[model samples]
Target: MRKHMFFSWAVLTGLLLVAIGCSDVSEPTTPTYETNLSSDEIKNSAFKSEFPLHYETYLRNDESEIMTEYGGSVNHNKNDGVNPLPEGYKYAQPYLKNLWLGYPFSYEYRRARGHTYALKDILEIDRINRFSEKAGLPSTCWNCKGTKMLEWTDEYGDSFWVKDFNEFREDVDLDENTIGCANCHDPKDMELRLYSVPLKAHLESEGKNFSELPRNEQRALVCGQCHVEYYFQDEKFGAAKKPIFPWAKGKDPEDMYEYYKNTGDTNIPGFEGNFVDWVHPVSKTPMLKAQHPEYEMWYNGSHGAAGVGCSDCHMPYVRLDGKKKISNHHWTSPLKDPDMKACRQCHTDKTPEYLRERVISSQEKVWNQLLIAQDLSVKAHEAIRMASEYTGPKPFNYDELMIEAREMCRKGQFFWDLISAENSAGFHNPTKSLDTLASSQQYSQKAIDKAVEAASFTTARDLAGDIREIVPPILEHSRELQMDPDHMASHKWFEYIPLLPESEKVWEGNERLTSENAH
Candidate 1:
């Protein structure tokens, strides 16, 4: 009986090795193509004839109607709590407009669509100043929009970054220039390559070379090129407005905060040598606005620490033709797949329903804490605003206390923004997400205490109320709304900003609309 069992086990092991050897799913092999395209080809369509199968999957990014419980490809307003479907969703965060007041994000910010819409969406977004001939952003804003950066950078060098964003609007092709194959692959041999200058520079600064890293790490790095947190360089640094990843100290929220403290040339009394994204028009506090930091948030999380790269879940391998396996190019949430095949790739024992429920459960906890942190942050801002304007008897350390309050407000909001801006809804790092929110609440509460103490507790009652009622969500705002006298007078916070001069839309997409070409 023992001899028979040993022979059966040996035969099973041999069969397994044969299966692994025949299947590309077990170990990916480099695909060879005979395309005669130019090495510098940036157009998505240019590679279609040579790689039809891959191109078909790439075009799948155009599907934008799907919605997960917490996120989706629908291009809806993230701040609207009352609207429905394509316009807004039930899971909306109401205070985004109030929190981001005075910044362009307050003008218009929406849930992101798929990668195919990058160029088109940016051209139409209100955040870019469509009402004026000059876009309010620098050309550096185009860094992640498309592959045209390769040609633009080669032609203009570092000078490409500081130019007006609108200058290249008419110069790009909507379908061809949007993010595609060339952004992550070398057309010559189809090997993964880094096209983002910011990411490349960051890797070099760390004395690491992308090509030398393991293939799994390279897969994540390709996506990290744009999915990570970044800020434009101050003029005091090299190439003004050039995009830079703040990874000098480390990739954690606390590490990034420490790095920003001395990276800028700002000379404001308390903000000296500090990087300030914008001054909160209401709180009068210098603030740091965090962009999506998915890469940072995931770096030390459960999967990343275990050597699972982003592509493992987001771009799962699939036999699209029912023969050769290829990485699915329709980058999106794994929960969108009915089978949750991506999760099952590693979690083979769990059912799709079970995996999805776990994700939503974690997100629900983070979302609740996120709202609480946001409320406290808003209260802190209001407390500072009231305290600064107080005429009552003050503490001897009023000035000192007010400065400390502002500092806390800054720290609290930034910590909150780090998690708020990340795309995973806290599933990326649940422990870190909850911990960060707790810190944010503590700092914001401290700010409120200091502000109240600075006023000798005179304004405590003024700040005592449901924050939702005290600071109603700003439901409507835009460059156009800012010009309307009635709209400008609708909110107390609006009183801080001057009304804009009446203006008409000057451009649409890549076209400069003159009377002859106007729609």
Candidate 2:
């Protein structure tokens, strides 16, 4: 009976795909609303005066990071957009390239930029272009980049996920679609409303619903829409694309590890366990990439325990003109603000200098350990590669041992990502950050130990000694890893001018394009 039911569903899915292919109507093929409210009605209900729906307006009026060089946050002096790295941020791309050599991230993954650069950066990234001429990427890439996503979701429905990313690039108006005020703003009153499909679905599976949550919880939920880790679950389905959050068990880094370890195939409803994002080329282990999980980190930290929302620290309210006050929507580090006023609001006893040092101290500690984790992880990969490739006598089969090593790498990288991928540099929850890093260190060392044990099975016993010797030199093997040391030296592709000329510069490299559709 179960087999028959699945067969029936497969047949229905096939029929639906056939209908989609045969139709000439390529525009959004789905209903826009679940209720009687039209788009205008929904807008009218949420906003009164015209809400500045475009983010460019805000960029022009107030938050001109390009114009002010993020108010000297970029490089300790006001200059331009081409170099936006904050003070003390060192280039880690060469290290990451070794870590993710088998994955597309190795092609290009820079430190994240402000919200305004979201769409432009993604469009310009080399990872997306590696196969853009052929397979390209899935539409899921557009999920957080722009406000056009909301419109595309309403128009295409489930079809949105299944379509090639290039399809939307060709079909939609990219310029007007960049993420803007309309995304989180309610058109009627400008109150925040959740629009993330994955967040809504994940919450439902966890036995909670977004709409029913209190205003405060909703604040966190709003951030969770894009900040949480997720994976594409229905890739094999071909016709249905689903981005699922593996939060059935919980949101902790360990909880997510367990969820990914035990969750089965998409055959199961609501839970995707034992998923594989990509198999590591060098480690040969099935791996999962951790997205920026600020929400999850904050959830496990002191602030969250104290019921402090993300906005309390990252987005603080400020008074201007001595009378009018509003929540600062610039969304940057509170410590970087001119006076450290946000921290003062909470810790009135601390001076701005002390608070700056406090945050920087925590970040430096995590950053240093993160590099150690990177070094150890790279060794784990080399160890596995040596063990598997050893051609000396007794051609040992270390399949099980390799599996063990991969699991360690899995946990190790996950923990590293918990700190490294997270937007906050450990300041959000210093204790949790350190604890997570300790786990990464432990897991990484275990992986190295397991790899050594496996390599000992080599027919030439001396090969085991050599494998041990080989592991220590992995960090210095950058040339062998095919990673270029000069990866961070160039930012020539970046455009720094804000609001003037009304459009940003074109990429101008191979297929160089602008955030707007024009060349």
Candidate 3:
């Protein structure tokens, strides 16, 4: 009997090893990220598959209902214990650009709680099936949320891979219900992990040991898996196709533009014609726009200088029941709990006033400068608009003025990015934030004025207008910086979750395949 039990244990271990492997938030505020898809609808789905049936059997055999036990409260709308999404879910943008920027969930709640909010495994697929039918969503929506679900996507990727979340969820057969512990944290060893082929390809090419970085740093990088902004270059185009980080010359936005200039060859997109942003409705000289610009600007600030990463304060590890170690997944700003151990770990001071003072002062300086950026941005837009009007659509050389305005606008946004990065705006350094913004704005305004004047009838259109690009050899440098292990934007979710092979119905191989192989 003892020998039989031991053999049973070994078999179970092997099966689990073959099971899905690999891989927050805050809130008394209630995890704002609950499922918008109806649970009843999901639970009611009629489709049954080998994946879903297998998960159901596993759950029944294991009796896993940890969500109700772990989560302190049940979701109010879902009516059952599994929490529904926040009130804001109705308005969430499909492409969620601003999310995971350290907002939504609080830090302590994230630490205290693991992911007890969503469906997983086969039951999750049932939920996916039901939810899609009820909510009118898609099954492809299940991608990246579960190993089994991601497995189902094998061979079917080219068609449904890039499809939107709702529509995707509705059409596909899902065993993966949503993002869960099995996706980010290694349930077998319980370390945060990435399961992508491209990430390692890029990292190794640049000599990065993703594991060598400190745990705190690791925490921040983990956030980068989904948090940072990225776009697919499209495999069909034979372009890089893999997700490209914007940091060739430097992580700075200007550096990114340097790469985008692509002056070396006519074959590159938007290079020879010298396109930047769409005709600045205001500053007619094409302007380079920005999304959040948080990652780069944050790096330029003090916290980053001190080697502080987002997870140091936001995803601090806490011991539960006196011994279990886990980092909080709640993805919110650390400032939410000032007195708690969160920010105090680094600040080393007890007084809220002093902390506030520091953040305010730092932010003020940056803010002052940012104001200049704002002024420059608005003024530059007007200048461009005025220039375009003066010259008509034929394209004239407001080059000097545009050079001035574009630089300022770029700097202003950079400053703003820095401010928004730190909790309490650089531990209360509003003064510096203000100062930086102010300076940037002034420069931007100057550039706009120059461009506006140049575009006037007094100047002839310089078809030969010299293209003076800033910061040389942008892409080479950007690629190098992007592949750096310490950098966050380096994450390549594009390859992190690949479609499974059609021949294999299994979610995982018999063994842990090397983390990455070919790009």
Candidate 4:
């Protein structure tokens, strides 16, 4: 009987080995970035080795592994607790195409993924690579990607901003670097330090020195280095476009808008002048694209006001090898923690499942309303196009009407982008998010009404007829806009939760649970 059992086990083991040998497990799907030249490959091949204490092997390739493990089979939405998107569902809002028309983002924009993917994803985007001769990207674009930025800044100083993106792409083999240990750590002690020059300068301009801040505040400020909204201003440092944060006025959505509108009145010395990121093709309004302002948004929230730093939630300490406790370097959404250790640290009353439901419920409310704002903005653009060509009678002067509608467009887009671009869906501060989305919807609707009213003077009724439902035929429209022909065809969403399905299907909360949370 013992011999028979041993033989059976041996045969099973043999079959498993054969199956493993035949599988593609030996070949990893992710590109192998190994360089042929070990020490001789790049000039600063061992640059990080110079500060051995500061550098650690931080690249965990955690996106696939973690998403598969904690996030549920690689297709689950980390925050919302939803599985992969269903058929015919698009991860990107189709209205975004209309909103960003005449801009590179209109060609392609995907939801952000892990820190490890930052450089690779940017390099692969169609928005930056539509043209052959020059990639539609500036060197300043690399600011948030990785730790090697310090070396590049030391070498080029301010001239780095003007250099074409490809210049650095060719010179620096990006496969070797990421937002690693060196980015936030000091070389000697591994203590936190802010390396972003723009952030340091901006803080100084406000008479609030970053280094003088308390350690807890500094932790979040390190993240603020890249997470805040900034614009590239010409001739501030050199001819190169230097990134200037609009913090002299304030950090709120309204404050940033006012600062952008009246740049000459800025309290930040030496940056007093009007700035324009891009002119909206449809509305002709000079638009501001609010980058992920997570720092700014959180700062205005209750938690941040209570001195909770970003690391508190996102980089909670985890025990490694069951002995050494260290902050998790795989910076990602805290919701992916199956153990709910991070959330439970603060919210002792709630379970992981409850927290997940609360998050999805809050986000769903904001997102559904956001889509309305988007649709309104699209219609506003169509109305503006009609009003521009109209030789109509004037209740308000044509140019004045155009200016008014454009102002609405500007304000609407600003509010919408603030909420939309922020990494956290409304969970950071539900009240603030809802309020901002409300303003966005109000402004968007006003823009549409203003545009339609102006277009009424035109003799051609068909021109302004049914401006509603005019989502730009973006798939076909890109061809007319001179974008890459194959961009839409080649568009790819992340494997995890690629397309958010209907709320009922993706979200798993009952009415009783919803009622319980409402209180």
Candidate 5:
């Protein structure tokens, strides 16, 4: 009996040791992976044979049909409320074209596709002027599109940024150059490394090194390389058109706004010290356009403060072969999965439906407030436009009052854009989102009041009614529309922009076209 018990005990001990070994396979770990590909490999296909599962999952970025309540992979017009399906979504924002009248964004702004389409979308996007040989933008626009930037920057150095965006069109390969493996990886050993020059510069400025950061922090920083807010460095500072994150003061809206106060060489009155992205054609306000700032929005929020990295939710670990777990390469909304598997990883007790409802509920409130703020912003612009054109006797302090109104209009619109441009629909930071919108509304109202005061109350009655009726949303505008005299005459604001000369699209994707190939 004693001998039999000893043998059973030994068997149980051996089983325990085997279970311990298998447990490591179930959790994600940085196992050493050796791919013989060059350290310079930027092509997605180069890593396919070596890491088949990861490559397979990465291809899922091509699935653009899926959508959640507020966001999805569908490449629809974000400002189109009149169209259906692939052309538009139910929650479209109507004021986008009006808000961005003078900017390239007014031409065509659509909901983004997955990262795999980044190169293709940017090439075809109406925001880039394709009709002209000159792209009308700096090469800096290509910074976030692909891994080829790694090669381009290496070859051209600082001069790469100021080059015409169209200069490199014929040299890029869509599939290979689209954002992929090499962007955040060291091809030598599959370790995380920072490839974005701006992100690296920002970190180093703060005396932080990417390698020294905790692994969890490194995961979020990889996403931050492209996801954070940035501006092209004005020539006065250093490298002209080079992108720089305005995180010197802090990551919050007010902090970045403060940092922008003295970053540019724009000598326009009232905008002397400010970094101006563009001057609003209608309001004549110096504006700051916020890019998609997911990283900034999430940084100090609930999940971020609690130590959740971007990958923890967007790229949850899953068993592809039903054995070893890997971080899913298909980066997308956590709510996209019907099971809410990513959320369940942390909130194990909550049902998927409950969590989803909570998210949509927060978004609904935010969306409503966002519309209100946008309406006020439109009213402010109208007020300023009227005040600028007023012919009656002006107040003694009219110049000062008008400057204050313009400043308010600038701040209000920027605050609105911060939330509007962010992809999360306020789920990333609901408190910050709602607060910013509320502040935007107040600033817009103040802008209207100051504009009226500047005009000595002459514009109050004109600005009092429903804003939608006052300035109907510019439902359609594009490079094609600008070339048509009738279309340019259709709107009062269209007068601010000169009509484009008749021209054919000179380039599409990576292909430069002759008349035979032009569309």
Candidate 6:
């Protein structure tokens, strides 16, 4: 489920600088791959190879402006057997939300008004649009921009376009950016090329209408487009539904769900409608779970509204010795190397701690909310199980119940991601985490009661059916926390990374640890 864009290929496959101007031939393009400066002296570890994670960034940097200077590694520990880079390199922790800069990009953007880019902020579409306006981007530049949602047709296809995932994989290249240059720009002619077979398949899926949009819109269609969040439903599940944006109703979570419900569509059909992403464990009512929502939320925020793009902040122009070129495609937070023109133009406060503290504080706040949401959601499921003992089953709506369960599971997942996306853990803004947690708790409790209410109608005669049948898939998919590895591991204690004791539960399947085993 985790696409792993950053951690997976953040440092993989490099582009070879071919004979600079003689690139108009039909020769196979070659790439130099991961740069050597990446690996430690002769250490050819995958940590430095294909899809390598630069140990240097993870190993060095200590800006006094914040608490931790170095981008702290989940794998960093004395016993982990590797000595980090030279001292003065403070820890730099990251949330997926921002650029991997060493200093605070947000604070700078705030001080600069509008000319500057908050390079360390999360990637957004408008940001790119503005950048394109500032720097002339040719038509071919549109390649790596988006999902290319060109319409297909009114007529259905007799055979599947992408018959299976393997065929899909062969045709698509996911090596760089989970997207990259070759997808759009012609490496050979510096022109644009479209594979008719592939585009034809796409057109047919949409009732054959690929060329309906405006020229610039079509040009803008590639690259930055798919960079947004989306929902996918497969043809096998119901009728063939192609990947479509749910924005016809409107944007924002509430608006989208309103459209789905009005459509009389019981569920997503494939993903199980279950309403929105997940349900609260405590609040039994269906709830909306949010993802990066990078485009929507970022646009509404001070950053995107002000006009910032993914490349503007995270992937900015870097002067190599004096010749200017965009920083290599190693996508990460700009905070990892702050003071770049992208950020420095705004953040006049040159201190590292100042920058780090800001992001850390924000991260911490998000994590706290995550924990609260997770705990309450789990408890609500337990409540569902308890309530089930008193219910009856008359041709239970298994379809609907599963829908509910999937929603709750996702709510729990959202918390985990919030933690993961939170760059500063609890350091960014402690209050932010506290505020979100409080609301999350309230919402979760509300969900829990709803599930109990669902089963309250059961009679003695209905008891013969699978107790699970009436419980709705929401409770069924809760995965009995005791047996889930993530849930079980969540209870274990770490000297450095601690969990709330109140949140801990004894494993139903595992035995207690002995004194010797505890170590």
Q: Each model's TM-score, in the order given?
A: 0.94, 0.73, 0.50, 0.74, 0.94, 0.45
Which stretches in model 1 have alpha-carbon errors above 4 Å? Answer: 1-29, 32-34, 515-519
Tens digits of per-residue lDDT, candidate 1, 231-275, equal 988999889889999999999888998899988988877889999
Residues 411-495 of candidate 5 have per-residue lDDT tens digits of 8988999999999999899999999899999999999999999888988998889988889888899998899999999988889
Evaluate all candidate structures by whole-model CA lDDT and list the values in order.
Answer: 0.90, 0.61, 0.39, 0.63, 0.90, 0.35
- For 139-179, candidate 3 gives per-residue lDDT tens digits of 33343344443344444544544443333333332332344
- Off by more than 4 A, model 6: 1-162, 167-178, 184-224, 234-241, 262-292, 325-328, 338-341, 391-440, 452-519
lDDT of 4 at 261: 63
lDDT of 3: 0.39
lDDT of 6 by residue, 18-85 (tens): 44435757665323343333221212122334322232222222122222332332222111112343
Badly placed stretches (over 4 Å) of model 4 are 1-57, 65-91, 236-239, 264-273, 457-468, 472-519
| CA error at residue 75 for candidate 3, angstroms | 18
* Candidate 2 displacement at residue 445 in angstroms: 1.5
Which of candidates 1 and 6 reaches a greater TM-score?
1
lDDT, ranked from best to worst: 5, 1, 4, 2, 3, 6
Q: What lDDT, from 0 to 1, does candidate 5 have?
A: 0.90
Pitting candidate 2 against candidate 4, the one with the higher TM-score is 4
- The segments of candidate 5 whose C-alpha lies over 4 angstroms from its true place after superposition are 1-29, 515-519
Residue 133 alpha-carbon offset, candidate 4, angstroms: 3.7
